[model samples]
Each structure stands twice: as structure tokens, then as C-alpha cells.
Target: MKLDVLALSGVFDTGLATVLDTLATANELAAAQGWRTQPFDVRVVGLRRRVRTALGLQVPVQPAEVANGAVADWLVLPAIGAKMPPGLIDALATREVREAAAHLRERHAAGTHIAAPCIGGFVLAESGLLDGHDATVSWWLGPLFRERYPKVRLDESRMLVASGAFVTTGAAIAHLDLALWLVRQVSPELAAVTARYLVVDTRPSQAPYVIPDHLAHSDPLVARFELWARQRLAEGFSLDVAASALATSPRTLQRRIEAVLGRSPLGYVQDLRVERAVHLLRTSRVDVEVIAAEVGYANAVTLRALLRRKLGRGVRELRARG
Candidate 1:
């Protein structure tokens, strides 16, 4: 398939890198599978002929000269930074970007795929492309994103989310997951190979996913500490340790957790540990002792107790179904 991508210059560096790199990986994998791949005709479209990075580096693109081009089968805007300049906003309002968005939307209406990663979702959302769709964005922007576009169902916890022909990703590296998903949609072997090449796990679904809404708003310290704790759950987790990570008292962390999720910090952590334990039991044939150690329980008895408490079943019973 001929995939043409629209990338904006001067967007968030990390977001841009994730989109471009992932697309490159997908294209490489597709070729190995005998799926003819077209070079991405990337047009760095902006208000000016020269695009400059936030760091003062400048790049030259084909003169905003091609005003009339064929609409692509796929349109991707990786990120547009946090805010558009007044002049750029005026240009957008006057229908420059709107025209491009409309062209993509028309193709999408005809079954083409459209995608946005991180802040680029804002551009699509503004053009009414995301109305009545489930989408995602950088977690830091969730509150403002929700306030700006209430029509879009925002699920920030998912690495990536797709609605119909429109695929959206939350935060940075999630863009890679979205690309792998698209590669899988087009060809599963290509997706698997590409994942191997990139050393990333294969995310094989194009449909939206259900995950904890972790990226939604939380007190700053609470969010950071929770994420840190999640990553370390295999070692062990504690409210006191999490509070120390936040440079705050355990009571403060407890209060913040209650304010944000209506649960104590430890309770939330326990939920995550139990959730992982359940997933391990269901998906892997590993022994319960290993699963216990993998999910922060120091002993099989602790794991068994948690399994019964959280799932009302023993680990063995949960595994029996699979």
C-alpha cells in the first residue's frame, strides 16, 4: 500500500521521533514480507517554507509550493507541540490546515486510515475529525484535552487507541505501539518481525484497548510515585517508599491517592499487583511461586491470599480455565 504521511516540523522532539522511527520499522518489515512498500512522501507542512525547531535548528522543505496534491491513503500528524503560534492559528482558522484535514477526512470517510500521536490529536480534534471517537493523548495534556474536546472519549492509560479509521496514541513511545498495530492490520508477520527488529513487544490489535486510566489527572507527586511503584512492583512496593520517592510523608501520599482515585496508595498498588498476577496466571504456564515473585509477593501464601481476595479464586483455578 502507498502510505503518505503528513509530519509537522518543530513539534515535540520525542513525539516526532517516535512516529518517524516506528513508521520506518514497519516499512522495513513490510518489505521483507513481500508487501510492496512505498517510500513515505513526508511533507513537512507548516505556515512557512522554512521550518525551525524549538531548539533554533532550521530545516528547509519543498516550498509550501504544492498547494494541490492528491489526498493520501493515510494521513499522520505526529505532534504539533503544545500551542500553535498566533499567526499559525490564524492561518489554520482561515482554512489552510482545515483544507488538509478535510481532504484526509474525506478519504477516511471512504475507508482510508488516519492517525495522530500525542499533541497532533489536538489538530485532528480541532478539525472535528475526532468527534464521537475514542482517542488518547499525552497524559500531561489530558485535563486540558478533555476540557477542549468533550465529544471525544479520551482513554489516556492505553498506549494507543483507535476508533474507526482514526488511530491515536498517548504520550511518546506509544506511537511505536500504534505503528506496530497498523503493520499488523496490514500484515501480522510484518508486525511480528518489525517488533523483533525493534526489540519491542508485538501489540497485535487495531481495536481500542481497556486499561486502567492511569494517565488521567492525579496530583503531580501522586502520578509520578505511582508510575515509579508500578515499574518496581516485582521487587516490592510500599506506601512509605513511594512517599519518599515523592519527597513527601506517607500520610500526604495517602491523602493524594484518596483525592485522585478514592483509594489509599497501598490499595491502588495492591490492585496493580493483583492485576498482573491474574494476567500471569491466565497467560503463562509458569508456577504460582514464580508468579508470586514476579508480582511482588514474597511467598506463595501471600500470593494465594491476594489472588483469593482480589479474584475470589485461587491461582490454580484461574490457570485451569486457560
Candidate 2:
């Protein structure tokens, strides 16, 4: 497959390297196994010949003018290194990003598979290709993603989602997952061999690592609700009571919460409780029943069920991992 990795200015250096290096390693590992791996002609193409990363690392990139003319089977967009909203805004408005977005649109029109992971998903989203597709972004960027691209169905919970030719994954290291997945698309055995060599464990969901505090802070109402929820965590939550205490009606609370966080108020509270339970399970020797109560569940039975439903693991299983 002819693949081009778009290396833009202010790009996160590690994310760009992860996809390029992992694919190269996959080819090597597959050959070691006496298997015929898919041919990957991966090139690091950029808007300029030399681009400075967010950390000011000087990276030599093939002039995008050159690769822009080459037909590619896949175009990979790596994450940008803007953590704050203003930085994200500025990065997206940069000349490199605009040029890259235009190229991505062209590639999609030509039927190239668009693969992006982490904050790079923003570029894909900007191209309007992800419209009406099940997509995901870096977990913390969920609200911004949804707000900026309303046409796309953004699910922050997934680490990987393949919708037709467009494949996206969540966060930094998922770039490796995307690479291995592309390998798996060619040959499952090759992906297996590459994964073993790299000690890359395949993780399906981003649920375990999502920090509610970080996501909530993006919206003042959500942040206020988070504080209120944590204070009453041991006592459980009532939507009506919460609305009254927060000086909002149940209808307004539900609407804003759903619009901003893409989850109901109840769901948000549950996330807080589950996060609390996970920490307690990992650090404390508390019994499951007591932990459940501490997290606002009436009993261990319900908490265990919720844990299985939300985390895909039972209480004992989570404890075992800890």
C-alpha cells in the first residue's frame, strides 16, 4: 500500500514517529516469520521540507508538493501538540494545517483510506469526511470535537473505530494500535507477530483511563455539577435535588449536560462514581460492598453489574488488575 504520513507544523513528534516506525517494524517482524506482509510505502510528507515540532525539534520532511502528486492508498494524519483550547484554535488556523486539510479532502475524494489518531482526528473532522461517521477523538477533546463538528457522531469511549475507509483511534499511543490494525487488515498473523515483538497489548476501550475531572472542567456547569456530585457521592444523586442546588431546572441541566458532555446528568454522575470506585479498588483493601457504598451504589450487587456494563469488567476483575 502506498501510505503518506502527513507531518504538519506543531505536530506531536512522538505520535508521528509511532505510526511510521511501528509500520516499519511490522514489515520486519512479518518477514522474520517467513510470511508475506503487505508492502507499505510509508513517506513522511509535509507542507514544508523542514517543520519544527511543538518542542522545536527540527524534523526533515519530504516536501508535501512532491507527495501531493503521488497516488496513495492511505493518508495518515498524526496528532498536533496543542493541549489548550486557544492553542488548538491557533494550530488549526496555521497554514500547514489548512494545507493539510485541503490535501486530506482531496485524498478522500480520490478514495484513499484516511487514518488518523489522537488530536489528528481534528484535521480529519475539519475535512468534513467524518461527517455522519462514527468517530472518536482524544478523550479530553470530546466536547470540543462535538461542538466543532456536529455532523459527526463522536464517541469518546472507543480507542478505535473503523467506519468504511476512514479509521480513527483515541489518544497518543493508539497511533500504534492504528498501525497494528492496518497490519491486521493485511494479515491477522502479521499483526499478531508485530504486536508480540513490540509488547503492544491490544486495548479495545478508553473507558478505564478517562478522567471525569478533566472532561468536566471544559464547561462551568459540568464542573459545578462534578463538584456537587463528588460531595454527595456517598449519598447517591437525585436529578431534581441536584438541579435545585445548582440553580437550574432539570430540563436545562439535562439539555446542557447532554449537549456539552454528550451524556445525561445521571451518566456523568455514574462516571464520577465509577472513577472513584476504580481508585479505591486499586489503592484500598476495602471490600466490594463497602466500596460500592462509598461510590453511591446501594449494594455491591448493583455496583458490580454497573462495573461490568460500563467498564466491561466486574469488581473482582478490576481488583485483580490492580
Candidate 3:
């Protein structure tokens, strides 16, 4: 498979290295294992001939203008160095990002499959190709992404999401997951072998790692609701009561929460419950039943199901990690 890895100035060092290393390993393992999978022909392409990573490491790249009219089968975009909303917004308005977005739009028009991980999704969204597609971004940037690209269906909870020809992954480290997914497209066996060699485990959801409080603080109303929700966790959630406390109608409260957090009020409440339960399980040696009750669950069974659904792990795993 022919692949072009887009290298932007101030790109995330780990994100770029992860994609390059994973694909290189896949190629090596496929050949060494005598597998019949097609080898990945990867090249680092950039708008300029010389690009520097976030940590000031010089990256040698082939200028996109001199690609000799070659169209790659896939174009992989790693996250940029901008780690926060303000910095990311500033970076997006620069000439480099605008040019890259234009170049990406042209590539997509020419039938190149695009994969973006972490804040790379911001660039892809800027290109407008993901406007009507389902995609995922770094969980912490969920609110900003939603505000900037309202047309795109953003699901920050998932580790990876594929829609049409675009595949987006959550967080910086998910670059590895994106690379493995590409290898799987060629040969699932080869992908598995590559993963095992790299000692990388599959992470299906970003929900387990997301900090709800951080996202909630993005909007004042959401922040207030979060505080109220925490106080009511052990007492059970009542939307009407919550709205009354916040001096708003239930419908208005639901709208505000959904617009800010991309989930209903009750959904956010459940997230708070899960967060509390996890904390209790890790910090204290409390029984599952007691913890569940503290988190507003009626019984241990309900909490167990919730933990497995949200975290993809049982109480035992959480305790062991604790």
C-alpha cells in the first residue's frame, strides 16, 4: 500500500513517530513472517522540505509540490503541537495550516483515503471533507471541535471512528491504533502480528480516560450543572429538580447540556457516577456494593454493568490497577 504521512511544522513528535514506527514494523514483520500481505510503502511528505517537530527535532520531508504527480493510496495526518484550545485555534489560522487543508481537500478529491489522529482531526475538519461524516477527536478537545465544526458528527468517546474514506482516532497515542487499523485493512493477521511485536493492546473507547469535569468547565452552565450533579449522585438524579435548583426549565437544561457536552443531562449524570465509582474503587478498599450505592446505583449488578460498558473493565481490574 502506498502511504503519505503528512508532516506539519511543530507536529507532535510521538504522533509522527508512532505512525512511522508502526508501519515500518508492520512491513518488517510481514516479510520476516513470510506473510503474503502487501508491504507498506511510506513516505513523509510536507509542505516544505524541512520541518521541525514540537521538540525541535529536525524532520527530513519530501516537499509535496515535488511529489511528481503521484497520488498516495492513503494520507495519514498526525496531530500538531498545539495542545490547548487557544494555541490550536492560533495554529489553525496560520498560512501553513490553510495550505495544508487545501492540499488535503485536493488529495481527498483525487481518491486518497485520509486518516487523522488527535488534533489532526481539526485540520481535516478545516478542509470541510468531514463536515457530513462521523469522526472522533481527542476527548479533551471535544467541545472546541463541536463548536468549530458543527456539521461533523463528533463522537469523542470512541477511540476510533471510520466514515466513508476518512478515519479519525482519539488522542495523541491513538496514532498507533490508526496505523494498526490501516495494516488490518491489508491483512488482519499481519496487523495482529505487528501489534503483538509492538506490545500494543487495543483500546476501543476513550470514555474510560475522559475527565468529565474538564469538559464540563468549558461552559458556565455545564460547570454549574456538574457541581450540582456531584452533590446529588448519592441521592439519585432528577432533571426537574436540577433545573429548579439552577433556575431553569428542564427543557432548557437539557438543551444547554447537550449543546455543551454532546450528551443529555442524564447521560452526563451517569458519567459523574461512573467517575465517582472508579475513584472509590481505586482509593478505598470498599466493597463493590457499598461503592455502587454511593454512586447512586441501586445495586452492585447495575454498577458492574455500567463499569464494563463505560470502561471496558470490571471492578476487579480497576482494583488491581489501584
Candidate 4:
């Protein structure tokens, strides 16, 4: 497979390196293991002839237009260094990034499979190709992405989401996952071998790593609701009561929470409860049943099911990891 790694200026250093290293390792392992599939032909393409990473390291890159002529089978966009919304917005508004987005749209039109991880999802969304597609971004950027690209179905809880020809992954390190997924497309065996050699494990969901409070604070109403929810974790969540306490109607409260967090009020409470349960499991030697009660679950069974649903892990696994 021919792949073009689009390296934007001020790109996340680790994200770029992970993509290159993972694909390079796959190529080596494919040949060494005598795999029938051909090795990936990868090149770093950029808006300019040279660009610097967030850390000021200069990288030589082939002109993006040159790569456009070759029609790479895949175009991978690594996260840019704009870690925050304001910085990311500023970066996206620049001439270079807009040009890059235009280039991305062109590539997608020409039948290149597009993949981005972390803030690179922002670029894909900017190009408008992710519209009407199920995608994911860095969990912390979930609110911004949803608000900015309302047409795209944003599921930040997923570690990776593939929709048609566009693939998106969560956070900076998910670049490895994206690369492994691409390798899997060619040869699942080679992908597994590459992952084992790189000491990388499959992370299917970003839910376990999400800090609900961080996302909640993006909206004042959501932040207030989060505080209220945490204080009442041991109590049954009542949307009417919460709305009354917060000086809003239940309908308004529901709309705001759904709009801001992409989940209903009760769902956010469930998230809070799961987060608290995980914390208690890690920090306290409390029994599972007691911890479950503390987090508003009726019994250990209920909490276990919830943990498995939200985190894809059991209490024992969470405790061990903690």
C-alpha cells in the first residue's frame, strides 16, 4: 500500500513519529516474516518542502501537490500541536492549514482513504469530508468538535472509528492504533506481529480515560450539573429534582446537557457514577458491593455491569490497573 503521512507545521511530534515508526516496523516485519502482502510504501507529505514540529525539530517533506499526483492509497494526518481549542482554532484559521484542508478534500475526492488521530480530526472536519460520518476526536476535545462540526456524528468515547473511507482515532497516541488498523487492512497477521513487536495493546474505547469533569466544564450549565451530580452520586438521579435545584426546567436541562455533552442528563450522571466507582476501587480497599452502593448502584452486580459497559473492564481489572 502506498501511504502519505501529511505532516502539518507544528504537528504533534509523538503522533508523527508513531505513525512512521509503526508503518516502518510493519514493512520490516512483513518482509522478515515472509508475508505474502507487499510492504507499505510510506512518504511524509507536507504543505511545504520543509516544516518544523511543535518542538522545533525540522523535517524534510515532499510537497503535498507532488503526493497528490501519485494518488496514495492512504493519507494519514497526525495530530497538530494545538492542544487547546483556542490554539487549535487559531491554527485551523491560518492560510497554511486551510490550504492543507483543501488538499485533504481534493485527496478524498480522488479516492484516497483518509485517517487522522487526535486533533488531526479537526483538520478532517474542517475539510468537510467527515460530515455525516461517524468519527471520533481526542476525548478532551469532544465538546469543541461536536459544537464545531454538528453535522458529523462525534463519538469521542471510541478509540477508533472507521466510516466509509474516513478513519479517526482518539488522542495523540492513537496514531499507533490508526497505523495498526491500516496494516490490518492489508494483513491482520502482520498487524498483530507489528503490534506485539512494538509492545502496543489494543485500546478499544476512550471512555475509560475520559475525565468527565474536564468535558463538563466546557459549559457553565454542564459544570453546575456535574457538581450537583457528584454530590448526589449516592442518591437516585432525578432530572426534575436536578433541574429544580439548578433553577431550570427539566426540558431545558436535558437540552443543554445533550447539546453540550452529547449525552442525556442521566447518562452524564452514569458517567460520574462510573468515574467515582473507579476512583474508589483504586484508592480504597472497600468491597465491590459497598463501592457500588457508594456510586448509586443497587449492588455489586449492577456496578460490575456498568463498569463493563462503560469501561470494558471488570472491577478486579480496574483495581489491578489502578
lDDT of each: 0.65, 0.86, 0.93, 0.92
- Candidate 4 has its poorest 10 consecutive residues by lDDT at 62-71
State in Å the error of residue 248, model 3: 2.0
Clashing pairs in 3: none
Give me the runs in candidate 1 sitting further than 4 Å from their true place: 29-47, 59-69, 83-112, 202-322
Stretches of candidate 2 off by over 4 Å are: 35-38, 65-70
Pairs with backbone N, CA or C atoms under 3 Å apart (clashes), candidate 4: none
Given candidate 3, what's the lDDT at residue 305? 97
Instruction: Tell me the TM-score of model 3.
Output: 0.97
Better of 2 and 3 by TM-score: 3
lDDT of 3: 0.93
- TM per candidate comes to 0.56, 0.93, 0.97, 0.97
- Pairs that collide, model 1: none
Judging by lDDT against the true structure, name the best candidate: 3
Q: Model 2, 213: alpha-carbon shift in Å?
A: 1.7
Better of 1 and 3 by lDDT: 3
Instruction: Write the residue-wise lDDT of candidate 1 on 99-217 in tens digits.
Output: 55665566577566788876678778876878999987765556556656778887554557878878888765666776677667767776778788888874333212223334323
lDDT by residue for model 2 (1-322), tens: 7888888888898898888888998777767767665467787888877887878898777865435466788888889899667889888887777778888888888778999899989988888889999998888889999899989898898899999889999989999989999888877887888898888798888888899989888889889998999999998578999999999999998988888888899998999999999999988889989998888888999988888878888767887888
Could you tell me how far off, in angstroms, the CA of residue 221 lies in candidate 2 after the best superposition?
1.4
Relative to the true structure, candidate 1 has a C-alpha RMSD (angstroms) of: 9.5
